[model samples]
Each structure stands twice: as structure tokens, then as C-alpha cells.
Target chain A: MPTPEAWAESFTEATNGDAEIGAHGKYYSCSYMLDMQERKLIVDMHRGRVENINLDVQPLDAYEFALRAPADTWRGMGEPVPKPMYHGIWAAAFRKNLSMEGDLLVLMQNLRCFTRQIEILRETGVPV
Target chain B: MPANGRFSPVTGRYVTIDLEDPDLGGEYKVFFLENGEGRPLVCQHTAGCHNHQWRGLLEDPDITRSHRVIAYDLPRHGKSDPPNDREWWKEEYRLTADFFTKFVVALCDALELEDPIFMGSSFGGNVALQLAWRYPDRFGAVIPVEAADYSPGFFLDWWQHPHANAAQVCASGTWDLMAPQSPDQERWKTWFYYTQGSEAFRGDLSFYSVDHDLRDKLEEIDGERCPVIMMTGTYDYLTTPEMTAATAARIKGAEFIEMQDIGHFPMSENYPVFKGYLEQALQRIEERIGATVSGQR
Candidate 1:
């Protein structure tokens, strides 16, 4: 697995460079956390661009929503071609051990952009 | 005419049917697309979607030559409006298995179609199973794609939440229902269809995830009479292959075919891939029903 710092840098760069997100993510401003058990990442976006990715997640670090899962599950989801159940949050949460917490309306609001970003994890791979 | 400017042979028409139930009974002007002749193959699109999902199947010369494809929009979906005289807006549109089955039977009666083969995906698929159980003699066969005995959890508030953009949420929420390998253009087209029916998606799921439970009633369906040919895509998390296979196993003489590399909205997301499995299912039905695709009324 890649280090947290390295993974954050690559994810930020890749998310910023994504053309699909750029085309449709003008209003996709939100901050969400990915809790992979071993580590957590809080990604902040501003007008479709990556504002920051915080590796050191404090207890009170607020985010609109959080997707929590085991390290292995994250690895499965980050595969270039994920298996049937690990394809998306709905799939993973329904079939696997992925847990979603916090305000879901915000997640649903930016679902299109967030879903595309999850696909980007396929290219970048998971740090855990 | 230019290649892209050419018009399709498929024709869409409206048929109004009066549902006779004292409670839910009302006039419904349903919209449908049809072409070709022979055995009638009536199709139902997934929840929060329209008959256009069957665009490829309706136009395919292979299927249409031997089968008349009739893809219809359910009431409150696509071009079909809600009950003409009822105060539908006053009450929540929670679809029930009873009303859905009656509506389809009434539609067939109005069109004077004889023993049409019914095929549907997702919610439509669930209703197919219900039809098989309730009205075995009404349909020649039921092709329930990407369905299970009891599909719960999808009937959520997000589709029509007051604070959310129901269109984007419903569309993007179903994004993963298609396999990542499906063509982007077709997947986007399916996504586009979902955007148009956000109002009815959740209501339709009332039957899909809640009222359409056939868990204990699977044995009630006489597969030999109705010939249930269930097909489910491997990538569909909502109705996984295992769930569909289990549901099929309970029905005596029912067959379950697992479709590879496709997802829930098979005909919409990737019709070419879906067509291969569809042909196999149709062949199985023909073998079971002891009738050829060219069999006439």
C-alpha cells in the first residue's frame, strides 16, 4: 500500500485533472471523509477542483458525510475493475462492509461528482 | 436523407384504459411504442425510467421480425399521466402488486393482445414475477431480469427528497447499477432516462422493494404454466445473481440464467451484451412453452 501522504497527493492531482468532473462539477463543492479503518482522508473540493486533502483527521474535523470500510474493502473498491458488490457506495454498502455516516442529503446532492471521484480511485489505487 | 437524420420505423401511440377498481380505478392514458408482428413481447422499463430503455430491442430486426415488441410507459411515467379523474396528487403514489397486475391485464384486454410474453427490468421484473404468480394464464411467459423474490432497501427518500435535486440524485444514484464495462454512451442514455422520472421512481419502488415480495409465495407461481425465465446480471448489487437464482429455484420448473458483464438495466446500458442473454432466455421459453417465436394467435 502507498503511504497516506503519497496517496493524498496523487488523489488530489488526479481529481483536479479529471475532465469529466471539470465539465459537470462547477457546483460540486463539498468536503467528505473516507474512513478506511487504518487511516482516514478528508477531501475538500471547491468548484470541481481539489481544495485540499487532509491526512491527519482530527476528532472534530467536520465533514458532510463519511464512507467507512475496512482496508481490504477499500483495496477491493480501488481495483481497476472492482468485483460486482464493490463497484460503488450503494453496491458496497448493500453487499459489503462499507458504512456511510453523517448527512446523506449533501452526499445525494453531489452524488454525480462524488460517484465520478470514486471511479478515480480505480486509477489511483487505495493507500490502505 | 442523411444517415443520422433517418427516422425510425418504430411508432409510438397512446391507449387509454379504465381501471375498474372502486378505489384506484380511473382512466389512464398510457403511452407505448410498437413495431413488427407475430408473438407479442410486452416490455416494461425499470423504475424512474421510460420505455425508451427498450429502444434497441424494439428496433432490432432479429427480435422484431418474429416478435411484436410493445414497450409501454406505466401511469405517471414517461408520457403516461396519472389517473385522469382521481386526486392522485393528494395521496402518495405507492404502487402495489395488485394494482400493477390489474393494470397490465386491463391493458392487454384493451389492446386485444393474446397471451403476450411479458419482460421487464428491476421493478418491472418484480411485477413480472407477481404476474406469473397471480395470473399464470394471462401471459405466455414472464422474463424477470435483474430481479429477486423480495427486493428491499432501494425504496428510499432520496429520489424525491424535498431538499435534494431529485433528478440528479435518482440518475446518479442508479449509475452504479450499470456495469462499469458497459458503453459510456448507452449508460449515459440510461442515466438521462432516469433523470426524467424522478417523480415516479420512488413510488414505483414501493412495489419493487416493498409490496412485490414473493419470498414465501414463489412456490405459488406455476412455472410450467407461466414459464418463468429469470435472468439477472452479475454486477447488480440490488438483485445479485445468487438472489435471483435462489428465487428461481423455489418455483417448480423455473429457470434462472445468469447474465455476464451486464447490470440491472441490461437492455438500456448495453443492449448488444444484453441481447445475447435475452435470446438464450427466449429460446428457453420457446422450448418450455412448446411454441416457436413465429407462433401466431
Candidate 2:
């Protein structure tokens, strides 16, 4: 299982200079926290680029938004061969496996960037 | 149990609307979700689908905060049951322009929404234009995604004359035109295309493929009262961007936009990719509303 720092590094590495991400991501600038029971990850996107990913922030009350899903759900999502609902944020949300709270519009507006970051962790075989 | 057990992310309830009466129907209830506050935005779904298509937008606090968003399932499509008066079971349930217009007007009246911006996709997209043409002042703006005045080449007679199974054909045909990048399971899953019963899909297609033609009438929709922004996806083969652009050219001030890497099913398939384009369109509508309010003052 990848530590929160390792997952953050993988996300930064994947989307640091992607052009399409920049285009669709232009409308977003927000802070989001992802909770995986034992571990928590926070991603800060400034003007459509990954500004930082802080791992030590456990409760994530400082961020504008937070998404909480069970560790099993995150593990399934991060698996190399993820099941259908486990692959994407919307899918998980639709299935009621994930609870998204706070600035929903910010999360949706920056959905692509956030989703890609999670996928990057999966691609890097990061343990939840 | 609702068809998909999918309730609206916002208020989960069914609102009553009189379909039979010219005035709002007090008899029948149409399933709808209304969320947030501000100027109302009435959203409609594509054929054979329900209002759940707008879930992502409904759930978004930013959009909901700025616009009172409402989306409803047409009669017989979702939780709203089929009409009792009509022998709908004996014949295919064709969606007529009259039925569509009345439903919309009645729903708006019931909700006490005045001049809400109307947004729709595919079959619902075509209805948006019809709504503007038929009742010019009823709407503030009409944003029709993947729509055209007349679909010259796309054929759906296969829906009725089944050399192959109609349900399978409709599902597969829809899958092809939907977001190519969406998961295959999502593309073929019965959830997306299987609602509204078996013949309902074919019945709706008759309106989409044959009855719904607004070629000359496009010019009749006033750009001021009902500002139109025609949008189509680059990947939508059924209603090509070229077709949507041609339709937009007929209106004096109508805007046209092509959503990149998107297909016919904007909400269901490849949502994150298509949402960016939807946001842009909504922003444009907001700008027009702002301008109109400013000018009137």
C-alpha cells in the first residue's frame, strides 16, 4: 500500500505538465481532502495545477471540500484491475460508497483534475 | 421501488402536474427534483432516460446556489407512471409536441417558476427549440445540446421495424453514439437505455426521427426572449456538430458550441469530460441573463 506522501507524489508526477488537464482545469482553484479511514490526503490545486498534496492533515477540516469513502473502496479503486464502480469518483458516489461534502460545485467543476489524480495513484499501484 | 432506486441528490419528491388540462394538471403527478435557490433552470432529459441525467449538476452546490435547478422525468419514463386516460399499452407511447409543451408549461406553473432557462439533450434538446418556437416568452433562454432543426440522415425506423430486437438495437445504437471513452459496462448496462418500457423507445424515436422538424420555424424563435445556444459534441454521430451549427445559423443571435471528446449522452457517459463544456454553456446563459436584467433596468 502506498503511503499518503507516495500517492501525492504519484499524482503530482502524472499531472504536473499535462496540456488537456490544464485546459479543462482552468476554471478550478480549490483545496480537497480524501479520507481513507486510517490515512488522509489533501490536494491543493491553484489555477488548474497541483500546488501541493499534504499528507499530515488527517481530519481535513482546513480544506474547502472532503470526500470520505471506506478504505476497502479506496483499495478497490487503487487496484490495477479495478471493478466498474470502484474505478471513478462519480461511480463510487453514484453507488453510495462515497460521501462527498462541502463545496460540491468546486469538486464538480474541477472533477477531471481530481479524478485523474486518483487514477494516477491507481496507475502507480499505490496501496490505499 | 423507483426504476433505478436513484433519487435526486437534492429534494427527492414527485410534483403534481396536470397533463390533460391546458391549465396545470392537478390530477397527475410528474416526478421531479428541485434544488437550491436563485433563477430557476428547468432541465429535461434525452429519450428513454429520466431526470437523473442532471444529477451531477443538481448535486453541485455552486450551480444549485446560483440557480434553482429543476429536472423532471416525462410521464411513463421514470417514477411518473403512464397516463390512465390513454390506452398507452395498446399502442406505442409517442411523445407529441403538444404533450411536451403542455407538460413543461404546467410543470412551470405548478412550481411557480417564471421564465426559467431551459436545458435539454437529444430528444429533450429538440423539445427545447419547440418550446421556444411555440411559447416564445415562456422561457428566459433555451440551451439545446446535440440538437438540430432537421436530422437529414439519421434513421430510426429500425426501432419500429425490427429485423433485429428493438431493445438490443436501441441500446447498441445509443452506445455507439455515446462517449467512446466511457466504460463498456456503462455503455451497455440496461440502466441507461432500458427505461420507459419496450415500445416507449420506439415511440419516442418516431418524434425524434420523423415528427419533430423545425427547419423553417428556427427563424421564428426570437433571440431576445429565448436566447438559444446550440451545442453538440464532437463525437456525436447522430446529431453532428455541423448539423447543430447549421441550425444555429438560422437564428440571428444564437450561439453554437462543440463539446470536445463528448458524445450524445453528455450526463451519463464520460461525465467529467462533458461537464466542462456544460459549465461553459451555463456560464454563457448566466451572462445573457445578467445582461438582460441590466438592460431592462
Instruction: Give the per-residue Cα lDDT of candidate 1 at B153.
Output: 95
Could you list the iRMS of every candidate?
0.7, 15.0
Candidate 2, B27-103: lDDT as tens digits: 56578887877778888888777777777778877677667888888877777777655555665456676777778
Tell me each candidate's TM-score.
0.97, 0.63
DockQ of 1: 0.87
**Weakest 10 consecutive residues of candidate 1 chain B by summed lDDT:** B288-297
lDDT (C-alpha, whole model) for all candidates: 0.91, 0.71
Count of clashes, each model: 0, 3
Clashing pairs in 2: A1-A127, A2-A127, B18-B25
User: Where does the lowest 10-residue lDDT sum fall in candidate 1 chain A?
Assistant: A1-10
List candidate 2 segments past 4 Å from native. A1-128, B1-9, B21-27, B152-157, B160-165, B183-197, B291-297
Q: Candidate 2, residues A1-128: lDDT per residue as tens digits?
A: 66666767777777776665666567557898888777787778887778988878744258888889988988877777565456556546644378888876555445445655566656766436
